[model samples]
Target: MELDFPKRKIIHVDMDAFYASVEQYDNPDLKGKPIAVGGGSKRGVVSAASYEARKFGVRSAMAGYIAKKNCPDLIFVRPRFDRYKEVSNQVRDIFFEYTDLVEPLSLDEAYLDVTQNKKGNPSATLIAKEIRKKILDKTGLTASAGISINKFIAKVASDYNKPNGQKTVNPEEVIPFLEALDIRKFYGVGKVTAEKMYKLGIFTGLDLKKKPLEFLDQHFGKSGSYYYHVVRGIHTSEVKPHRIPKSVGAERTFSENLSSEVFMLEKLDSIAGELERRLQKSKIAGKTITLKIKYSDFTLQTRSKTIPYFISNKELILETAKELLYQSELQDSVRLLGISLANLNTEKKKAAEKESVSVQLKIEF
Candidate 1:
C-alpha cells in the first residue's frame, strides 16, 4: 500500500550533555575535565555528565558514590536548574529565527519543520549547520543536529554525530540507512524490547522489515504497528508547535501526608518553579493559574484565577499558588498539592510559512 503525504524537511536539534556543558561553558576551568552535575552527597544522583565523564563509564542517573568510584577524578557539581532554564530559552529563540515549526522535546532538544522557511533556503542541511553555529555563538555551547524527511529519521540522524556535529539522511538514502542500523538503535527499542527482538531473530532493521505485520502485532501488541512503519522509513508525526497548553498543573503525592504548612509550601514552591520553567521554554504566557489540593481522604478541590494579562514570571506563579492554598478550607491532612498554568498565549504566528512559490511552480509545470 502506498501512503500519500507531502514530502517534508524535518530537523532534530539536541544539545550535547546539556547541563554539564552549560557548567563547563561558564567555567573555563571545568573544560575537558570529567564533570557530573547533580548531588555531591552520598545519596545524590548524577543528572548530567560531560563526555570526559562518559569515557570513564560514568553516566547520568547513577549514584554519586558509584560515579565517583567509576571515575576517581570525577568532579561533581550541584544542579542549577534556573541557569539551565535560561540557556534553554536562549536556544529556543534561535530556533524561531530559522523556522517556527519548532517542537521542543525538553529543555535540551527540539524538532523543526523547515519544509517552508523564512530564509527560503532550499537545503535543510545548510539550515541545520547555521542553527548549530548560531547556538554556539549565542550560548557558548555545542549541539548535534539531524536532518531528514520525517521525525523518526531526523531524530535518529541527530544522534549520528555527538558533542558538536550534524548528519543528514536524504530521501534516497533512507532505505539503506534503515536497513543497516542495529535493531537496538531503532527508536523505542530498549533493553527488554531488544532482548525480545533478538529471540525473534530480528537483529537489524532489515530483519524487522521482513517480519509479517500480523506476527509483529502478536508479539509486540499495539506498538508493533509503529515498528512496522518505522522500519520502512515511514513516520507521519507532525512537528507540533508549542502553543496554548491544554492543561497547566503540577501534582505531587507525598510519601506521608502532614499538616505542616512549611513542608507543603516547600513542595508548592518546587512545583511553581517547574511551571514557570515550562512556560518560559514554550515561549508562552498564561492568564489562568489553578491550585489543586487533594486531601488524605481522597477528596479533591481546585481554585483558579484568570489575570488580565498573561504571566510567566516564577515569583508570580508561586505567590498566586500560595494564595490559593491559603484560601482553601483545609478539612484534612493534605496528601497532594498541585499547581497549573492554563489559558496560554496563542496569538503568536506559526512557524514555516506555506511555499506559495513552490506551489506556483508546480501549477505552471
Candidate 2:
C-alpha cells in the first residue's frame, strides 16, 4: 500500500572510541584499560581515546602530551587507517542489508534512514538495537545508536548513552529533550562559539529557542538561522549515500608561504600522491585532471585538462598536474596546492543507480 504521509526514521550510529576500541578489540589485554590511538611523538594529537581516558579529560584532537599528563597510564596505539576502513566497509555492508539510505559521516559514524526497513519493523529503536548487535557480532566492536524522527535529534541522542548503548527520542519527546540540552551540546557550537553563546547568556536550548531569528542572524550571521531551527528540533538534511566519488582530490596548506615555483611543484607532487592513493583504492578511472593553487594573499586559481581516454595511473595524474602548474604564472607566494581527477566511469554510476533503486523501494513499499 502507498504510504499516506512522509515518515522519516533516522538513526545515528557512532562507535565509542572508534580507533582505540578497535585496538582493544583486537588485543584482549588492552580491554577495560585506558587507551588512546594516535602518534606518540611530541607533535602528535589524540585521534581517539577510550571512555576511561575521557573521564580524565582526554579527548580526540587534544595534544598527545596533554593527554598523557591527564591520564598517566594511557596506552598509546598508532592509527591503522586501512584496518579501520575495512571495518567501516563491513559495518556499512550491514547497514545496506537494512536500508540503502545510509550516509557515512566518517569511518566510524553514519546516519541510516530506515523508515521502510527490510525487516518490516516499525520501531526504529528495535532496528537500532539489531544493527548494534550485528556490528558487535561481526566486528567485535561496541557502537551507540540514537533513533529519532530527524537527523539532528538522532545524532544528539546517540551521544547521550555512549559506549555500547542506544537511546530513542520519539516525536512527542523532542521539545522536552531539546529544552534541557546545554547550548554547548548543540552540534555546531565549538569551544569559541560556546563561549560566545555563554557570554550572551544562552546556556540551554530553551534560551536559544527564545531568541529572535533576526537577532540571532544579526549576532551569528548566516548560522544564526541554523541555530534557531536546531533549538526547536527541526532539521531537513537528507542522508547522502556513499557513491562512486565524482572527484578524487587532495589539498594542503603550507606552514609558511613559498614564492618559488620549485617549492610549489613539490607541494603539488605530494597532493598528487594522495589523490593517486585514493584513485587506486576506488578502482576508478578519470579523463579530466585539475590543478588548484592558492596565493599567500588567499586568492585561488585552477587549471584543468581532459584526456581522450580515462586513466587511473598515478604517473599520468602527476604529469598532468605538473603541466597545469607550469602553465600558470607565479605572481605571488603559494600558500596551498591541490590536484584532482574528475569525469569518472560507468561502473560507479551503475552501482549508485542500483542503490537508489533499492532506497526508493524501501521507502515506497
Candidate 3:
C-alpha cells in the first residue's frame, strides 16, 4: 500500500530522565530523591539529573561541583549503560510492533513513522499512548511522546508535556503550533544558533517564517533553507533505522580525480567534517579510523588504524584521518575518498576522565 505523504503520522518518544530514572527504578530508595547519574569527582560532569535535582537548577553536563552547589543534597550514581541498553531494547521492541520505520535518536529517544502501522490504527495519538503504556509496564519507567504530521513538530510536541506525558498536534494545528514555538526550541537549533537567531530578531518560529528564503540563506547559509521549510511544516526527513551498522562514516566521490597531496588533504578535511556530523547525530563515537581510496582506474586501497580512546570530534577525527591518508604512497589518482569510524562506543562513561588539555590517542598508522 502506498502511504499518503500528506497524511503521514510521526511520533517522537523520549524516555524521562533516562539514566537517572533507570537508577531509581532499580533502587527503590533512590525514588523521589534528588539524584544525578554521573561520576562524583569534582571534575566530572552530570550526564543525567533526576526531576528532583532539576528543581534546584541541577542539569545534565554541569560540572559536579556546580551541580552540587545547585542542589546540596544531590546524590550521584555511576551510569550503567548495559542496563540502559537492555531497557532501550525493550522499549524499541514496542515501537517495532507498530512500525519498522523506527529511528533511534539516542539510547532513550526515537522517532517512529506510523502512517501505515501494523495495527491499522488511524489515530496516531492512540499508538503513542499504547507505546508509552507498554514502556511503563515493561520497564517500570515513564516516557513522553509527541504526535504530529512530521518529525519536527512531533519532536517538539514530545518535550511540551514531558516526564510521563503525551501531546499531539494535528495536521491543521502544525502551523499555529510552530508559529508559537520559540526559535531556541526548534529541533537541531542549539543554543549558539538560537542566540544568533535572537540577534537577527528571529526569536519565534513566526518571526523565522516571515524571512524570505534568500534572506535566511544570506544569514545562515545552507541551514537557512532548512529553517525556512521546517517553520512552514515542510520537513520530510525519514526515520532511517540502523539496526546494526558495521561502521558509521561519510565518503565523497569526486567528478574529477584528485592527485595532488594538498588537494587530497583538503578533501579529507571535508570528509572528516561530514563524519563528525553523523557521529553527533547518532550520539556515538569510535576508536578505529579507516581511509578508503578508490583510484581513477577503479582500483581500491584501504588503510585503517585503531586508537586507544574513542573519538568523535572534528579536530581529532581529521587528525587521525590525515594520518591514515599519508600511510601508504598512492597507487594512482583518487576518484573517491572515504573515512569511516568503526569499533563504535555507544556507551559514554558517565564519569569521563578530567577534560584533557589536548586529545591524544595512542595508535600506529
Candidate 4:
C-alpha cells in the first residue's frame, strides 16, 4: 500500500529577546545595556535576558543573585505581562492578515501554515520577511523567522540567525539539510537526550538515519520512531488554530522556607485560590488535583488525587491539597508550594492510527 505525504509551507516566527526587548523599547535608559527581566530579588529567578546580558552568561531560569554575579551592571526590571500581551496581540493580528492557520506557541512565537495564504503569494520565504518587518514596524521590536516544509524544521531554521534575520529551507533542500544537521540542533532533543544519543554513537542526522527502526525503538522506546521519521523530514503534525490546553495550574516560591504545617496551610490556601482563579478564567474544571512541593534543598515532590466529579472551586482545591500535604511527613523545610488541576473537561482528540507512507512526492520550491 503506497501513501503520499502532504507538502506544506510552514513558517515559525519568534520574537527576539521578547521580555528584555520590550523592557528596552519601553525605557530608553535600558537600550543596548546588559539587562534581565525579572529575577531581581534574592529568591527570584530570571525569566528573560537581553543579548547583552547573554554575553556574560546571564540566562533565563538562573538565580537572580547568580545573574548579578555574572553581570554586575545588569539591570533587572519587573515583567509587565499586560503590556507584553498587548504587543503580542498586535503581532498576532499581523499573522491573521496572511492566514488564519496560525498556532501560537507563546506570546513571542507561533507556527503559521500559509500554503494557500490570503495574499495569493506562492513564496513562503517572502511572506516570512513581510511578517517580520510588520512586527518590527508596529511594535518597535524585531523578530526572526524560519520558512520550511514543516513546523519542526521551520522552528530549527528560525534560530540560525539571531536578533533579526530569517532562514528558508527549500523543499528540495530539506532531506540534505536534515542529514547535515548536528543531532543536538534537533528541536526536540534536549541536553539529556543529546548526551544519550552521543552514547549510542548517533552524533548527526546521518548517524541517526543509519540505525534501523527496530534498533531505535529498542533503545528510545516510542521516541525512537519519532527520531527515525523526523530525521528523514517527514513530520505531519498540522498547525492547529486553536491549541487546547492540557491543564491549569499556579505556584509560588516563598522568600523563606516554612517548617510548620500551620505556616504552610496559609500558603496552601493562597495557592489554591490562585489556581481556582485560573480555572475560572479558562472556564474549565478538572477531577485530578495535584500538590507540588519543592524543598529548600531543591528536591521536588508531587502528590495527586483523582476524584469522581469535576471541581473548580478554591475550597475543594485547598481541601485536596491539604490532604495530600499531610499524607506524608515533611522530609525537609519547603521553599515552594503549588496546586495544579489535570484531566480537564475539554475536547481532547483520541490518538490517530498510524499509517505507512511509501511514496515520496516531489515538492517544487
Q: Which candidate is the best by TM-score?
A: 4
Residue 266 of model 3 has an lDDT of 85
Report the lDDT tens digits of candidate 4 across residue range 189-219. Answer: 9988999999999999999999999999999
Structural RMSD, model 3: 16.4
Ranking by TM-score: 4, 2, 1, 3
lDDT of each: 0.85, 0.83, 0.86, 0.90
lDDT of 3: 0.86
TM value for model 4: 0.88
Better of 3 and 4 by TM-score: 4
Candidate 3 local lDDT, residue 319: 91
Q: How many backbone collisions does model 3 have?
A: 0
1-365: candidate 2 lDDT, tens digit per residue: 22121247899999888888889998999998999898655556799988888999989977788899989999899999999999999999999999989999899999999988898888789899999999999999989999887788899999999879999987667778899999878888888888999999899999998999998999899999999887876676667786456788889867688888787766777777788888888787889998888776667798999999998777888888888878857879887788888898734433333111111223321
* Candidate 3 ranges with C-alpha deviation above 4 Å: 1-6, 243-365
Better of 3 and 4 by lDDT: 4
TM accuracy, model 2:
0.71
Q: What's the number of clashes in each of the models?
A: 3, 0, 0, 0
- Top candidate, metric lDDT: 4
Candidates 1 and 4, the one with greater TM-score: 4
